[model samples]
Every structure is written in C-alpha cells, then in structure tokens.
Target chain A: MPHLPPLLAKPVDIAPLWLVERVARMIFSCVLKAHPDLFARLGDYRESRYCFSPSDLQLHFRVVPATQALSVSRGTPPPADAHIEGPIALLLGLLEGRCDADALFFSRDLSVSGDMEAMLALRNTLDDSAIDLPRVIGSFGGPFSPVVTGFARYIRTRVLEGRETAWN
Target chain B: MELICPAGTPAAFREALEAGADAVYCGFRDETNARNFPGLNFSREELRQSIALARRKNVQTFVALNTFMRAGDEALWYSAADDAVALGADALILADFGLMAYVAERYPQQRLHVSVQASASNPDAIRFLVETFNAKRVVLPRVLTVQDIARLTSQIDCEVEIFVFGGLCVMAEGRCSLSSYATGKSPNMNGVCSPASHVRYREEGGSLVSELGAYTINRFGSGEASGYPTLCKGRFDVAGAEGYTFEDPVSLDVIDEIDALRAAGVSALKIEGRQRGRAYVAEVVSVLKKALGATSAERAPLVSRLRTLSEGQRTTSGAYDKRWR
Candidate 1:
C-alpha cells in the first residue's frame, strides 16, 4: 500500500499530554488561588516553600520535572511539607481522582517530606480546592469530549458509591 | 514468643515497655522507619534512651529502617541501619534488598527481621529473604488467611510475625499506591497511610463527609459512627452506589484466633497502634497477654470489648477467615 502522509500516518495520541497539562493547569490554578503569595513568587524554581497566606500554614514542596522526579527523590522526605514528584501522569492521576493519596503514600508513589504542620496545611488546602470530577471536566474546552467526560462521570459516580479504587 | 509493639514517640516507647510488652519497635523521625508520622517516632537521643530503658527490663528493641532506598541516596538508609546497630538495637527490621545487602555485609553480627513492607506473600518470596539476607524473621502481610499462614510456615525457614490488633490495612502491604497518589505523603515513603494530617470533616446536606486530601472517602449520618479517615476503610461511591467496597471501618481483633495462629507456627503477634496512649496500650496488651493462655471460645468476649474501643466500634478477623472479601 502507498504510505499515507506523516500527519495522517497515525491518529495523534493527544490524550496523555492533553490530559496531564489540563489537570496540571487545574492544580496550578487551585494552588495559586490557595496561596497567591506563593504563586506570585513561584518563578522557575525547582523547589519551594508554600506558606499559606493565613493561619499557621506552611509547607515545603519540591517540583521535579516529570522525567527527573523518580531519580531526584526516591521516597517522601520527612523534611518536605509537600511534594509534586513523579511523571506528569501520576500528578494527573491525583487531580483526576484516579489515584488515592493514602495508597500512594503507602506505596511510595508520591513521597512527602516534612512535619505535620506542613502536612496539615497541604491537606487542608487540597481539600478546599475540590478540583476533581465535575469541576475538572467542566473546566475543559469544547463540548465535553465523550471519552473525557465519561471518565469524569464514572469517577464521580464510583466515588459516591464508595468504591474508590478504579481496578475494583 | 515476644510481643512486639510499635512506638511512635519516646513516650509511646516508654508506654509500650511499661505495658508488659516483651519488645517495642520504633523508627527514627524520618523516612528510615515506616511509622514516619509527625510528633511521633524517636529522635536519635530518644531512641538511645528508649533502648537503654527497655534493656533494663530485659525487653528487646527493634528499629525499623523499612522504606525503599532512592538511587544514589542509599547512604542515608545505610547510615540509619548502622546507627540502629550502634545504638544496640536487638534487631533491625528491614525491607529494601539493597539495604539488607548493606546490613548483611557491614553488620553481619546484627540481627535482621524483614519488615512487613516487603510483602512477602508466598513461600518463594519468604525464601528469597531467608536465602539472600539471612533475615531471622518475617512480618507477614495482613492479607494471609490462617490456612495460608500454615502453608507458608511449613515452607519458610524464618520466624513469622503477624498483626493481631489495631488499624486494618485492606490493600496488599507495601504495594498499594493510593495515599501518595492523592496527597503526596505515603506509608512506604513517609511512614503514614491515610494520614490524619490530610483528613477533613465537613457537613454537607445534613451528613458529615470525611475527606482525605481532595477525595471524599466517607460520609456519615447522625446515628452512624464516623471512622478514622484512612483511605482503605473509607466508604466511597462506585457505579452510582455507595458502600465500603474496600473495607469496613474496623479494628483487627485476632484475639480469638491466637491459638490457631500459635498452632500455625506464628512466632510473634504485633499490635498496630504505636501512636496510641499508654493507657490504651496497657489495657490492650494486658488483655492479650492474658488471652494468650485462654481458649479461643473464651477469647470471643475480649474481641467484642475491643470493638467498643475501635474507631467505628467495629471489629474484624481480617484475613484470618478468608471469607471477609
């Protein structure tokens, strides 16, 4: 058979990249809104301390590029208040509610470092964001892509049903 | 025949020792140990004093340096292992093969017990530890049935330690990535699972929703008991129906099965709450020590009493019966 043009050689797999960046932006927006002071100074640093605007809030977070995260930190650092490590997919997993933070912690899939104060701040901030499910899906452009929208709906429904793990 | 208990802090360690525990296990206040909770576990000085105190009572002390070693950062784990040995730890409960290799090579004289984080579920996995690292004991994961334990004990060369009480982890030990996937702190990495730091309780539609990180794991009505917001026991919605698909909120009460476990060749029975207060530890341990001699039928009432002390006032035999799933 004659070769098709490179553009049409294969249907683009924009799902992974699109999915990750979209969710990253959501997490970004939530964190920015949660701590505007920290976001204003985020700059391009590889590591940061995200001290909340008020309360006794403080956390040290390290942002490793997706590829380098595995090699940079093997496990959560007790000194780090929060961590954004792992491939972009893993972070996306959290934002999309496809992952459980408790399981991740047990499996060392997402490592954290630091004291409980930092831990408490990060947890409280993330809880307040509620960026998963309908909110995440609604934020995306275009009429809800059936595939993405379906996944979001499924997650929400399952979460409501008390079956947290996707595998189950 | 030792009763190994966890101690999240120096006070907890002293508490465990005073509570008739034959031995207490603790970790440094870092990733080196599995119970890496804040305001918990021991500092180096505290560990030293704790060990000395336990030694005075002829009680053994073990240090858990259980988490995996990051590439190029094996030194920290190694140093922790070495320090544990230096501080006169009776045994070092280890998980990582690389760390085990280091300890075997450097501190060959020091005893090594495999941490439950290794999740050696079968004879082959247990054999690997025995042959490779010469581990003296293996803390079996909580997923095994009593029959499974019998089969495993018949094949493995090492002593077997199993969880008898306290928090129930439904997932396969050391394998599930649920917690870190949510809030970025994990048991394997940070030594905590479904950590309290990440838990939030909010009132919604006249119900109390318990959230861990960004996910609502459970919701309770006025008459219902609210369980600790651990990810595994958290009730969630699946396929548009709500129920606990993972595990019910309950404490493991193997008190009734102690005789069966003993007959199956279990070498040790572990109580899970190192973060618990001295009063709770003393009460539970004292009761269990007494139950160790009682018949299984007689132990049933104690199990009921333990349920009253559980987070949601529920109790389970865990994987012992094999029908819970």
Candidate 2:
C-alpha cells in the first residue's frame, strides 16, 4: 500500500461516500475528454453499466456511457454488465500501464466479473496508451498546473520510496 | 561463468545471441513452456530457425519443456521433447519426473538440465535428480541464501545454475498453489499464473481499484504506482497491521554479489523474463555481458542501469542476503 501524507490520509479516510463519488465523476469527465479514443473504443459498452469498488475506502461507482458523456452515480445504480474491485492505486496503475494486469490479477490484487470481452478490450486499450493520471489531472489546473504537478511528483516519490524501504 | 538468457520469440532468440548470451533458452508456443503468454514463444518451425541461427554463432540453444505433464495429456509433452531433440537443441530443460524419465531413456546422448520449477534446493534432492534423470545441471530455486548455496554446491555432483536477475517468486517455484486455488489454472499444469482473462481494473470513489477473480488483493492510494499482483507479493491485513504478509513486489537482482556467487561454485548465471520483449532481453544481456567482464569497480554503474528495468522499480538481493529471512 502507498503511504499518504498523514494530513491528507486522515481526511480522505473520513470523507463521505458522496464527496468521493462527486470527485470521481469530475476527474473521469476530464479523463474522457483527454482520451476520446479510449472512450470511443468503449462504444461496445454503450448500453452497459459497469461497477467499480474500492474496498478499503468502502466506496463504489456505477458508470454508463451515453452518446457524448458518461453517466456516473454514487450508490448502486443498477445491475452492471461487469464489476471490478480492488484498491485505488491498482485501478490507476491499470490505466497508466505502470502495472502489469496479469501480474496483479494473478496475485489477487484486482478482480473482475461478467463481460470478459469488455474487460479484455479495456485492458488492451489502456496498455496501448500512456495515461499518466497526474498529468491528466494537472492539465485542468490552469495557473496551478506547476504546483499540481509538483505535488503529484512528491507524493509519487514518497510512495515509491516507502515501498522500496519496506520491501528491500 | 556462462551467462544464460531467456528468449520468448525467435526475434528475441536472435537478439540474445547477438547480445552475447552464451546460451539462449526458449520453448514452443504451447502449454509446454512456463511462459505461455499469448503472442509469445516459437512455433516448431520458428524454433528450428532459431536453432540454426544459434549454430552459426556457436551459441547453445536450450528448449524448456518445463511445465509438468497432466495425467491424460502426457503425449503433448512427450511430443515436445521428441521435436526439440529432432530440432538439434543443445540441451533440454525438463521439470517433470515422468517426462525426464521418458527423455532420459529415449535419448541417452542428449543433455538434460533440471528446471527451477523442480524446486531442488538441497544437495540430496539435487543428487536425486542427477542420478534419476541424468540431469547434468540443476537450476536452484530462489529460496536459498548465498551461504546455503555455497554449502550445497560443495556437496552436489552436478553443475548449479542460479538466477542472477529478473522477477522474483517468493513461493517455492513448483510447489506454489496460490494461483490454482484462485484461478483454477496452475502454472505447473496450464503454464500460466494469474491468467489475464480474469483481471479487472475500475475507478471507485476517486480511487482506482484492481482485482483478480473475486478477490481484492491490494489497494493503492492516489498517485502511488501499482504493482503486479502475485498472491505472495500482495499486501494484506494481518492482526490489525496492514502490510505485505508474504513478500513484497520487488525484482531479484544480485549483480553486486557476482564475486561471491562465482566463488560459491555456480557454473552458470541465468536471467529470467521470457515473457518480456526483445528490447528488454537485448538491453539486459548487453549490460550483464559487460558486467561479467568488468572489474569490481566497473560493475557498480552497470548494475544501476539494470535497476531501471526491474518489475517494481525496486530491486532486492532476495534470499542471497540473509537479512531478508
């Protein structure tokens, strides 16, 4: 697990489910614009609903694709075409191709249910692109872009160093 | 010491030979090889071409029929052995006792190297494999410390091959059943661990999540890089403490201990990662080739270069350093 700055960690741990959901919706809205090709490929999932759950934070989101926008809900929206669950870091890793999907799944770090073809398509698409979350998020910060980038770099460094210390 | 490397494709096989690998190991594109990932491995025709290429360069070619044979599917593995010999491979790397027996009896003139999947760590076990299957060399499992390996080397009759670098498996190679329990596919039986068809990733509540089958193996905080989730390397909550319960997500790297390993009577140094691409194989083989020839002072920089390619951006001496115990 990645180590969070104590100040940020506490608030996040205590944050309400609704707030978390709202933030996810906003970030994903920007993400879809940044990678239109990725969302376009998800056209096969047009009528499908997918559920994503982060177990540690006890948060979940139901996602559906519309013609131009994605509809996301905080609580159980409906029966999903596929369900994916794990930790926040791994989900991001899959998007960025920083983590190997097969390796994580083999270790039982991540899981998926229903619609195997949809899942494979998503995986292959992500693997083909370089989706850096920090850069994507920072792209929207305008004047604060440098600050956002710096903070993201710092947090990433801290997490990597902590993991190295623990493992080595 | 001989430097052995892995080649998943015919292109990688040629790359390894050109990059100074003393020998290159590869397998057919089937369940017969441990790295049975899609789009990887060679067909029989490809292997024949690869062997011919290695012959011209005077480099050895070893075929790995390392996965264990299922009871009803022995013919598939048996045919792999027969074809590898027919293709004039320099040696055969085998893991199963029955397959070993079959190869030993039919092809007495062929050389055999015991695969690491056999998990033969001790001298007695190594000796048994040598006597029973006529294994000329044994690839030691990654569980032994340097001193333990040195001790075993002194007693064993055959040559010993040690993994010098690449991905680390915390569990005993052939004995691990964690994948089978969750995925219904065993590396020993199906030649894959954590098959990709079962992996899924999702975004929830501002956090990204990764899962395998029905299990939530790990969670990462925002901005943290996630690692491949092998069961042993995943973090878990044990007794209110949340951390890695078995092993951490780190690759094995023992370049710093080359002198010690050489002194310990290791005859060959193996580099893992057949599932990796030709570029990875080429870069690693080139650097390690220089390191193998360099003096102690010259090796430090070369070792650092290889670290950038490690699995988790972190490297460990693994069991070579007893502190890990």
Candidate 3:
C-alpha cells in the first residue's frame, strides 16, 4: 500500500522510452546470467512471449523467452502470448520469486490475459529458479558489492511492504 | 477435526505449519505424487529437512504416493514409499492396490492411509482395505454428499477424512480418464492433469479461449474471470445444451460445515491445491484454523474471507449440499 516514488509515479510515457528500455535490458541480462537455467524449464512455453504490464505506471515490458529479449513500451503494449498487469512492485516481487503470483492473482490484485497455461509455465519455471535480485545485482560488482546489495535490499523491503514474501 | 493442508514445496510446508496446520502433506518432486508439477514438490533432502522440522513442532507429515502404478514404473513408486517411511513420514497415503500390498507386507508397522484416489465410497470397499492392509484412515472421495459422508463414517471402522476446500474433481476420484483423453497425461499416471505443457490460451474476437491438447476447454468474455483449464470444469455441448455440463469453475469450500463434519466423525478436513503457492496455503490454513476456533455463529464470515482465494473468485460446497439430482 505504499505510494510509489515521485519519479515513477509520473506518467511512464513521459520518460525516455529508450533509456528505460536500455536499463531494463541490462537488469534482465543480469538476471539471466545469474540463473542460466531460469527459462529452460518452461518447456514449450519458453518459445512464447510474456508481457508484464504495470498498471500503476502505465508501462508494458514484453519479454521474449526464446531470444532472451526485453522491450519497454506504452500505449498498445506489445503483442505477446501471455500478459500480466499489476503494480510495478508486485511484478518485481515476482521477478525474485518472492511474492506468490497465484495469491495476488486470486485476490484480484492483478489481472492476467492471454495464455494462462503459458503463464503457468513461466510461473513454475520462475518459482524454482530461486532468483534473489539483491544477490544477482551485488555479484556484478567487486568494490561496490555491499553498497549495491544493501541498496537493492532496501528498495525491495520498501516495495514489498505489507506483503508476504516466499518465507511467509 | 484436525486440519490437514497441502504443501507443494518446503516454503509452503513451513507456511502451513506456521499458520496452525495440524498436519502437512506433500509429495516428492516426481510422478509418484499426484501433484507432480514442474518446479514444485520436495527433494529427498528437502523432505528430510521438513520432517526434522515437523518433529520439533509435533506436526504430522503425510507423504502422498497416491498415483496409480504403471508397468515399468513400479520401482519408482516403491522407492518413493521406502524413502517416505525412511524419512519418518507420519503416514503414507497410498492408492494403488499393488503398492498398498507391497507396503503393507514390507512395512507392517508403518501407518497407511487410503488415498481418495482409491474412491472407497462404500463401507464394503472401506472395510476391505482396512481388513486387507490394516489401513488406519480413508480420505473419502469428493463426490459424496454431507449426508452420505456421515452415513459412511458411521458404517466404516477406520478414521474418515474428507476434502473441505480447494479443487473439486467432478469425476469419480482416481477412475477418470478425461485428462488422459485430452492431454495424454493424467493425475493418476503422470501426476498432472490439463498440464501446462499441452495447454494453450488465446484471445479471439474479444473473448479468451482456453484449450487443452487439441480441444477447447472454456471461454470467457471481456470481464468474466478466467479459470484453470481442467477438463471437468470446461464448457461443452451435451444433449443439445452448449453449457457447463459437468461443473462451474468454483473451488470447493465447505468450512462453514465444520461442526457438521465433526459431528459426522470426520477426523480430518483436507484442503486441496498442492499446486498453489505459500501465500495461498498460509492464508487458507490460517483462515480455516481461525474458523475452527470460532463459535458456530462466527464461522461464516471467516469462510467469506476465503472468497478471493477460491477459484474464479467464487465458492461452492459442491456435492456436500446434494441440491442437484
């Protein structure tokens, strides 16, 4: 229930889409590097595209699992085989496999469209990966590892305030 | 009645325990268990750790080896049973008669539970299993009405357990081949039904369509809540009526009938959804535990809190009411 930061609270379309897309791609690459087998377990759905829409930010992030590609956009939202819309925090909570996707979905805190089966495929794959975002981000740095990891953990704590994590 | 809960992973298992679960049931991360979904279930190491933890908390652990045995897969089922007993599982929930016989003969002192997959609806079948294998408990199939459950509980000699919440299988438990016919996999054989591997969803003309294997399962308009594509909950044409012939997409929630269930001699109330996450398990277990502690007049609202967690955001007592012919 925490209000988003002033910068992110602004209409996402007003931001430079290229810059955001570039930063998002870098993070996605880091995640894939940390867990190389992340999407391999998706089976057939690994060939599918998944769209993550942040209802609060009005932004869409379409990820192509086969190619390990991510694109950021607004308006029409890229065509994908599976799509989920929620607060940006909840979406990132899913990124680290911290929040339970089924719980949020059942509560109507989020909406999923397109291929539910494919989405489930993605969910199961993500759940087992045990991806910890703070560790993944911190591993990339030598001198600044502590600072970056600490900052990342702080952000995660704020983002997931009033929410239950995987540890319950 | 004791509250039994499902846990697909170690995390979910802990959540259930923390939420006041009397017993936590889980399966190995393989086809030996009915909920053999990918990225879920326990490793031998995980189950060992879970059992160690459960012992400290004095909570029982039930390991499900409920799937039917296949010709070449007998060893897997046998090995799973050995490991579960070795890890000190409080009980082994078994369905296959062959496996049951093997376990009964080999581990004579180990407690055995007749899995619902056995579909022992009648007293004769229940008594046969109890006499044959010395089964301690029988999880009644979800097809029976509350009245039938009460009558059967009275007639049977073993302890009775019934499904109180989560997914409802319209077909007779353990005997249906609908999922196999559609997806070439079944809960009894492969531990999956309408598996994600063979399922597809697409939007056509503003309606979302769900398909399993090659057949259409269900369709939802713009605002209608979508549902799991289990074949039993699908829409199909039957006798000139193109509608949901089997069941609507609603989870079975009979928590409000807990007092009645206790009166009928149900030893445990089982919650389904081994495929669900920790949050769902924690919430449902906590809510049910609270409802059990509440007075009869205070129980309905506790059950109402579970509405959001139910499938399709709706709830049903299912066959418990016996409202339909």
Candidate 4:
C-alpha cells in the first residue's frame, strides 16, 4: 500500500480536531457492531492498549480492548501496550487484512514498538475475522448502502492500485 | 511427489486445498503440536470439519502431533493422538517416541509419518522408527544436502519428505536449546522458538535493535529489511567481525531444485509456515503446484515471485546443496 497525496489530506488537515475525533468514534462503533468477536481471539492480550499512528495523517487513534473504546487525537497519543506506525493506506490495508504485516515489516514499510506478542495476536485475529471495511461502513448507511460501499471501495482501490497483494 | 502444505486455520486449509495441495497438514490448538502460537491452529471441531472436507475433495489430511511430551503430561499428547486418529486423519505426523509407541500399539492400522522434530537423518534412525512404529514416511531435517538425501533415500525403506519452502531453522532441528537459553521456551517442548513474548524491537543510534530476552539478536540500519530474532538467523560479533554467524535471516525455498529433489527420491515436498496467513499459504501452494507440473524453464519466474514472499525478501537453498558452511 502507498502513501496518500497531501491533497487528499488537505481538507481533513483543515478540519477541526473534535469533528475528526467524532467521525473516528462513529466508524469504530460501526466496526465493533459488524465484528463482535473481533477481540475474542486476542485472548490474554485483549486488555492490551493498541495505538495506530498513520504517518501520512495528523490523527492518531488509541484502543484499549478492555474498555472497548476508540479515542482519536491530533498529536501523540497516550502510552500503549503496542503501537504501529505506517502510511494511512498501509494501516487500512492491515485493518482489512489485505496487506501482509510480516512482509510490510520486513521491508521496513511499517514500524512497530512495544509488545510483539500482543500485536501478533491482534494481527492473526484480524486476518481470521475477514473484516470488510466497505461493507461495514455501508451497512450503517441504510438506504445509501450501495453508494457508500462503492465510494469506499473506489477509494480503497485507488489507494491499493498497482500494488499487488501477492509479493514484493 | 506429493505437494504437502501446512494450514494453521480452516481458512488456510481451504485455500491450500483449493490451490491444488495434494495433502494439507494441520495441528490441534495445544502443546501437542509445533507452531502452537496464540490465535492460531485448529480446535478439535475445526480439525474434524477440515478432515471431512479434504476427504471429500480426495486430498489427504495429515495431523501434526509433532511436539515432544513432558513428564506426567503424556496424557495430553496421547489424547491428542487419539482425537486426531478418531477424526479420520489420513496420517498422523508425530515426533514423540512414547506417543508414537502408544499409537503403534493402540492403532496399528493408522499411518504414522515421523515429524521433522524426530530429525531422523541416518539410515539407522529411520530404520529404528520404521521398524519399531512402522512409520510410513520420515520428514528429514533441514541439514541434509541433495547427495546426502539421495544416499539416505537409497538406504532407507520408507518414503522421504523434505521442506521445500517457508521458514528456515538451520539448527539440528528439535535438538537446539538456544531459544530456551534466551526465552525458557523451545519448539520441541513449548512449540515456539524465540517465542514472540520475549522478542522486542527498539530504536538505538539510527538502527532498529531486535532483541530476544536480554540478548540483542541483530541491528538493522535504516530501511534495511529485517526478520525475527530466531537465534539461528541472528547476527552476532564473531572473531571481531559482526555478521550472521549462525545463518542469515532468509527463508528456505528450493523450487529450483525440484528435479534434483525428485531424482533424490523425495516422495513428498512440504511447504512450512503453519503460523502464516491463508494468503501466504495460497500463493506458495499455487506457485509450487505449477512448478511441480511445469518444465524447468517455466519455473524461473515463479521462483522469483516466491523469493519476495521469503522472510526479509531473501531466500536460500539451505542445506539442500551444502553450499554454506
């Protein structure tokens, strides 16, 4: 997965932090509703605090599975049990289990710190759950499901375009 | 030769079978098998369902009860063997001598394949397993050259299985204690080598320092590809020169040596990584399946793609040719 253009982040960069944080919370709620057992496979690490910091964006999201809460901030987030930093596209690809985390890490495209086991457990759990972001986002749109799904898919395609998920 | 693939999950098993695996090997989610990582492996019900699907597709299913049993805990491994057999596994891939003996006496008709953990390289070792437990096949350790394999095949009575792709551990398989010395966990006992729980990566002086417990395994400069600190593949300062002293961080891929392996009388080719995702399983299975059926020249590009999938985007023929000393 490639990094997004600065132009794509222009509008979001200008948007107020509260508005962005609210939107992130709403999306997180939608994801949780779609995959109730998402953190079930995490087992002992279910309580670990996970931080996702997208290098291309100003936003950082933190999640503590024990609380089932997603909080977003403009600057550095609080201390986490595990934290992963990468391009927003790569982060999304990993969320959808479309990108190979090991491959991405091996190639130095992503950087992770803190508990490796907790992060690996999360990765495996996510991969097995088969999270479809477009579908999940669309499911919340009611009558506008198809249009929402199409737009999400189109954006995802553009982000992942020419990047074969195969290898290298 | 049969194409045997590994499946840690049902989704991986389905992908392997769908990608044209002749046999798919999996393990129960416990200490009974190797690659016993969190959020991985199959439950009893999952194994039962997977075996049924493989049988319907006419593909063999091998259950890996490959870990050694601990004292007073033999019952756990023993029960796993019974459950795997009861689920109609085409073969039980086992490494424990006591468990193998138990299976031999109780389920005489069930087929047994010596796991790589057994490290049965010599004719005598192979003969011992085959003679005592009637093991139909033996998965050779990753320390044999093609010539060594050919010679062993010429002398042994049972079929030979060799690792053709995936994670490479260059130690004397199942006998190494480096992981335990660092993490107090070894694959033979706990089904993990350099267990992730003890692994940590830290930024130090513009380099990424990967450590296994208190021991620093390797340091990677900016933008350099890196792999897990599996001790065997870690870099260390030896004779005042720092480099990969044991083995480099690379995966084992012998796609180019298919003809040589075949001529060496390998009865089955195995792709490792039971802990990998289904996409990895699917890609490796499909490409290798094509290579097995294609001419040598047609295998070139496929081999190239496989290297990209290898750990750290680097690969080796490993001990297959004995080129590295």
Query: Can you list each candidate's DockQ?
Result: 0.02, 0.05, 0.31, 0.49
- Residue-level lDDT of model 4, residues A1-168, one tens digit each, is 388798988788778878888888888888888889788778899899999999888888899887788887777667899999988988888787677677778887788999988988887787677778888878778999999999999998888764435531
Q: Tell me the tens digit of each residue's lDDT in model 3 across A1-168.
A: 334676767855577999889878887898888778787657677788999988778679999898998999888888988888878888778776677676565445667767766887677677656678887778667899999999989988978876644243
Off by over 4 Å in 4: A162-164
**Clash count list over all predictions:** 38, 14, 0, 0
Cα RMSD of all models vs. native, in order, equals: 18.6, 9.9, 4.1, 2.0
Candidate 1 stretches with Cα past 4 Å from truth are A1-168
Clashing pairs in 3: none
i-RMS for every candidate: 16.1, 9.4, 3.8, 2.8
- Write candidate 2's Cα lDDT for A22-86 as tens digits: 67777887777777665443436555666776544445667665543334444454477777776
Reference-based lDDT, each prediction: 0.65, 0.75, 0.84, 0.87
The model with the greater TM-score, 3 or 4, is 4
Model 1 lDDT tens row, B1-325: 5688877656456656776788898888677777665445666887899899999999999898988887887788988988899999999998889899999989888899998898888999989888988899999889999999999999989899999988788777778788988788788867777776676655567566778889888877754655666778778788999888788877788777777888999999998876543334555676776677677777777555555456666778888887833
User: Deviation in angstroms for B125 in model 3?
Assistant: 0.6
Model 3 in CAPRI terms: which quality? acceptable
